[model samples]
Target: MAKGSRADHSARLAAFSAGIRATRGGKSLDINATKLLVAITQADDADRLADELVAKGFRLTRLKTHGGFLRRENAAALIATTEDRLPAALAIIRQTCRARTVTWVPPFPDGIGGIGPAPMEIEVGGAVVFTIPIEGVELLGGDVAESLARTRAAGGAQ
Candidate 1:
């Protein structure tokens, strides 16, 4: 095969740039929880959503991708929320979930409108991301379990 010179390389680069431009195009509300994390399947969209959330008034804490310990190397965004707005944010998330290709972590208290605040506007291609209640710290064996056991015991053996 004849080794093409600079002209061949330039032509290839031009084609790549044109392809990129042909594809790229683009364009939340409530909440009042303490801390909430939004887990997304795609990192690119996750970051964009984080920026939108911040602009809408929520305080974003961690907006980085994490991978380890059974994690699938997905992207996550953590936002500071108040109590009342949590439910509203959840409703927005569920509505957004109808389109995007991702899973989400709900507010800590669990259930819809648990404790995290609601998002401003749902992304056109966003999905219903599930929530995992994070106590903010790792607990050793017997710590959480034992505490829960005691609490259950205190409930009059029901």
Candidate 2:
């Protein structure tokens, strides 16, 4: 390949990689052996928890969700990491998302008559985590590929 052709190839590869990363919430393809889908019910704690997780070297893809029972705002954080790092991710979530008591009024019943909505206290603000196994990961180019290369060079698990 010519010198200019090589540069063009690099630029094209970078753009392709960036497109992939953008679809995944700008998170790099860390190529981990395990994937964790952590559903955090308390929307209020999402920002802080996400920042802390990133600081600890974990990449996350956040999804805005709603709770079925409470019908309240919730967030689901998708984290990909090696099996060895699973405990660390879980620990961060546990430490960041603390359970707390919340008071709310229950919705009125459909058939019952002369009954008013009553306040109820319940516990909330905790994370529900699910672990999944990832078979493989492929990075196109750019910083994500470089990072993956560095991880492999350091003898980290693929």
Candidate 3:
């Protein structure tokens, strides 16, 4: 098949699978039992952490964000997993997001008379993780979903 045609066929197949995965017997599918929102302030650590999680068979959705007193670049990783695998996910995050010291300079106000911007060393680069109990999760049209379903069907240990 031509490359374009093959791509088109793949797209259609994915859409069809997504429709099927959305509902089963008119009911939504719930696959995940736990949800983790991990905000990693250190941009440098984001990719490494994400790769490590994927390597460990964990799925993550990354969102680019900027915040904190310094307006630093951040990556927020959304992880959905079973309750039994929550600890493993946390461990990957903890191991990858290491704390380190960074120099920060405070900008002086324009109206200030004599004070100038002062640079100070501060601790930074850590992962802020929040674990929330998810009532349900719906995974649609992807290898991850298929693998998860097969695991559940086989009563695989999480």
The candidate that achieves the highest TM-score relative to the unseen native structure: 3
Ranking the candidates on TM-score from highest down gives 3, 2, 1
Compared with the true structure, what per-residue lDDT tens digits does model 2 show for residues 43-62? 98899889988898777789
Per-residue CA lDDT of candidate 3, range 1-158, in tens?
36456444443323222212233334443343345555554788999999998898776789999988789888898886666778888888888999898999898888779968789999888788887765544554545444444544555433
Clash pairs (backbone) in predicted model 2: none
Of models 1 and 2, which has the larger lDDT? 2
Positional deviation of 86 in candidate 3, in angstroms? 1.1
Lowest lDDT sum, 10 consecutive residues, model 2, at 15-24
Per-model TM-score on C-alpha atoms = 0.34, 0.65, 0.68
Alpha-carbon runs more than 4 Å astray in model 2: 1-30, 110-113, 138-158
lDDT tens digits by residue: candidate 1, 1-158: 13364433333223212101111111001111343556453444565565556555555554456554324444655643545556655554444334443344433564656457543433334443545443333224433333333433444121
Residue 85, candidate 3: Cα error in Å is: 1.2
